[model samples]
Structures are given as C-alpha cells and as structure tokens.
Target: MACLIKGVYIAEIDRQENRREDKQIAPTWWEAFHFKCIKVLEDDVDSSIFGAVFEYMGHQIESPKYVIAIRGTMIKSRTAIRDVYMDAKIALNELSHSSRCELALEAVEGIIGSTHHTNVWLAGHSLGASIALQTGRDMAKRGYYLETYLFNPPFLRLPLEKIKCRKIKDGIRFMQSFVKAGVSLVRKKTEEYDPFILLNSWIP
Candidate 1:
C-alpha cells in the first residue's frame, strides 16, 4: 500500500510538471501499471483544488479500478494559497464545510457517472489528504464505498471542540480508524527506502 501511494504521488508530480513542458515525459510506475489519466478536475469555482482521475486496467481482476489522485499545496498561485487557508480552517473547524473537498468529490462523482468500475480509490498528500478524507466520507453518504490512501496528512490534532457538526465528527472518527488500520497493515520494518521519509522530505 505504501509503495502504491508513493507511485501515485510521483505520478501526480510528473503530470503537473509535464503540463509546463512542451514534450511530455515518459510514464512513471503508476502509468506503467496501465493507469491512464482520464480527466483533470479543475474549475473556476473550485480553483483552489486540483485532481485527476486515472483508469486502471486490472491485470488479474475482471473489473477495472478508478483512482482519483489530488495534488497538494504548491504555492504557485492565489488559488493554492486559498487552498492552504482552507486546510487550516478545516483543521480548526472554522468553516461549516470545505468547498475544495466538495469540489474534488464532485469531480469523482462526475467520472464515476460515466463509467462502470469494480472499486474507487482516493489518494493524496498533505492538504490533498484532508480533501480526500472529506470526499471519501461524502461519497460514503451517497452510497459509494471508497478506499483512501493518504500520505503524510496534516492537521493530525484537529480540534474536536470547534467542530459543531456531529456527522462531521463521526466522519473524522471513521477516517482515523481507517488510517490506523492501513498503518497497521504496513508496519513491518524494511531495510529498503522508506516511503514515509520520502514523503516527509517532499513536504517543505
């Protein structure tokens, strides 16, 4: 799972960098696994958040999987700054809801509406992780089961006292349990390069 998350993160970076260059770079490990970018989700209303949907062709499974990967803060524009503010507001429970997260969820729903898939997975790093978690819960409410893989998530100490919504609190609790289980699954010590350390280095 850690390896998969790292591949997704690298792929996202590649996709962003490639957008600026004239010639596209070669595909990364995630793309090598037959994960092709199907849509890039960005709009005027939700300018703060950016995400991409990739269609993965399963080698063994009969059905395909859809993976939605979101990009974290880059400090490249006003929208990026707004998204960073949203992350802080969400952590402190200053806002009633997160618009950026909702936008990402809407993008996922749009993609899912167009195709049939076996399962949907969400992944992101830093601020993107928060959006992914919030989006996952929203999808859950809409009768969609989504598996999420978050890398180096911020706002670990979100103030529960500031949160007024009981449903939102419940969603946070569910996310905590889900993350804890994922951590347990990948707790084994390894002599190889640690993805956690790599993720930390990437974060500022």
Candidate 2:
C-alpha cells in the first residue's frame, strides 16, 4: 500500500488570558513536515515517506507500511506548541484541561479510525509526534498491535531509549530563543515562510 496523505485543521484555545476564540491554520501548514522511518523488526530504515513531511520535502509515499498518513494542523509540540502557547497569551485565551485532552483524543480517533489493523507505527514531527506516542500507548492499552516512532517530539528523558516516547501529559519542555524567533519571524505572510519544518534530531 502506498502512503496516504490527508490534510486537516484542528481548533484550539489558548489558556492564559481568558479566551473563547477559534483559530484556523491552513491545511498546507501541515504540508510542511518531513520524516524517514526505521523498520522496527528489520535492520534497515524503510526510507519510505510515511506522512505529510515526505510530501513537504518533495518525496512520494511508496510502501505497504506507509499506507495510512494523516496531516493535522496547528498543534505544534515544543516545536510548534510554543507558538500556540505564546499566541494564546497574545490573544488572551484559555483551554480547560479537558478540552486539551479532547483535542488530542479526537485527532487520534481521526487518524486510527481511517487505517488498517496491520502493524501500526505512529510518527509525527513535533506536537504531532507527541500525539503519535500518546496514540501508541492508548492502542497498546486497548490491545491493538502497534509500534510508534516519534520524530523531534518534546524531549523526554528516560533511563531506556524505547520508553522515551510514551505520553503527552509527561512531555518535557525546553526554552528555545531560536524557536521563538523562527515562529515570530515566519508568522508574517509577507515574510515568505514554509510552515515549521525542523529536522529529526533529538531522542533521549
């Protein structure tokens, strides 16, 4: 099966200064992720484009395992979530804790509900990657056969490498001036930007 690329936008509310507004990110915003997968049971990296990033980076999805890919919007993790947080501060909005979970859960449902039961591996660039890990855990708890690969997810330290990508509630954060600057500099339509497309380098 060839990898599938579907674009979607999710709504979010910032939780800092009291807000009830809806923000919309372009479907193309997700058209900007890139990733390569390492086969879990094999010694080789598949080199298949599993999701939107591959397309963003100018590649095509061509393999059985890469068949189900869904691109979601605006839920940036440390990489993109910071912008969500700061933007909320600017707009004076808030997300009740439950609402946050709803956002993630709904996304998980949307992604998984559209796929087959074959060996599942969840991978996302940033916040999307974090969600992928969360989905993996949920699927395991529900007895679904799945393996998850996260790319540049929020840095989480673990005694073991395999447990590094586990939960979203436990996601760790690091202050980054460079990320903030990039978000600020690229938000302007006049600035000529390609949605946040950072490399996959960071696992602990």
Please give, for residues 1-204, the per-residue lDDT of candidate 2 as tens digits.
112223321212122222343333323333344433211111012211123322223354432233223222344332244435523432342222223223444444554575653423445444445445454554544545454555555543434445555563244323344666667776654333232221112121
Q: Give the worst 10-residue stretch by lDDT in candidate 1.
A: 195-204
- The C-alpha TM-scores of every prediction are 0.58, 0.32
Q: Which residues of candidate 1, in runs, are more than 4 Å off?
A: 1-22, 26-29, 43-49, 62-64, 77-80, 94-96, 114-118, 156-204
Per-residue error at 165 for model 1, in Å?
A: 32
| lDDT per residue as tens, model 1, 120-161 | 778877777777767776665555656678877776576888
Window of ten residues with lowest summed lDDT in model 2? 39-48
User: What overall lDDT goes with each candidate model?
Assistant: 0.63, 0.36
The residue pairs in collision within model 1 are none
